[model samples]
Target: SSVMVELVGQMKDNLLLDFGEAKKIIKEVVNVFDHKFFINRKYLKQEDDSHFQIQFEGPKGMFELQVPKNTTYLLEGEATVENLSSEIIKLLAPKMPSNVEAVGVYIYEGYNKGSHIISNISR
Candidate 1:
């Protein structure tokens, strides 16, 4: 979910010195995630001038959580990668409804191994 999205943003930020480099950095990071997470920009129906955007799964891995689509801010500091994943699981586990859907798991590989753990809701 947001974990990947935020992580992608972080990757983009860490490698990019300015907006001009965002695209390159984003593509590089997405490749590591195997193109699972992607940037999304959506119009917010609640506010005409607002928008709800995110970088969630695109193809590689799918989400299995049942969190209601709400803008919840996740922490990004002082927590180990595994701990962060645990935190996200804790927050989302209770919300997971028993049904036909894939379960959540951290995408591992390269530096993306455990640093940017993430989850998402699926249809």
Candidate 2:
């Protein structure tokens, strides 16, 4: 099993139509992970038009992704930060808006970490 890792990142402001759009996109990605992963929408919460949080669980372990209307996102899960970050970017790229240029992700794991730039999404 992999150690738990947290990934924090951001997108351009107003990158999503609304919290619903964010949830839908997330659900799509989660579903792609197969039946082992399921979102717990009951925990869904929104502080305002610009912020939202979604939680889910899977074989990898509990996962949480937060989108703060400002387009900032935080994702925590059980996996190597780099591997998890890349997997997310790869899955999300095809679903993102055509205008999205890139997403910057910073990883954290027991005080050891690094950053990644998932660019050329439109490509």
Candidate 1 colliding pairs: 1-119, 36-58
Q: Write the per-residue lDDT of candidate 1 for residues 23-113, one digit (tens) a residue.
A: 4544453343331222222321232223333334438764333222333222343324454454554444333333312224363435534
lDDT (CA) for every model shown?
0.37, 0.51
Candidate 2 vs. true structure, TM-score: 0.39
Q: For each candidate, give its TM-score against the true structure.
A: 0.26, 0.39
Clashes of 2: 1
How far residue 101's Cα lies from its native spot in candidate 2, in Å, is 2.1
Candidate 2 stretches with Cα past 4 Å from truth are 1-16, 30-79, 110-115
Model 1, which residues run further than 4 Å from truth? 1-78, 100-102, 107-112, 115-123
Q: What value does the lDDT take at residue 86 in candidate 1? A: 47
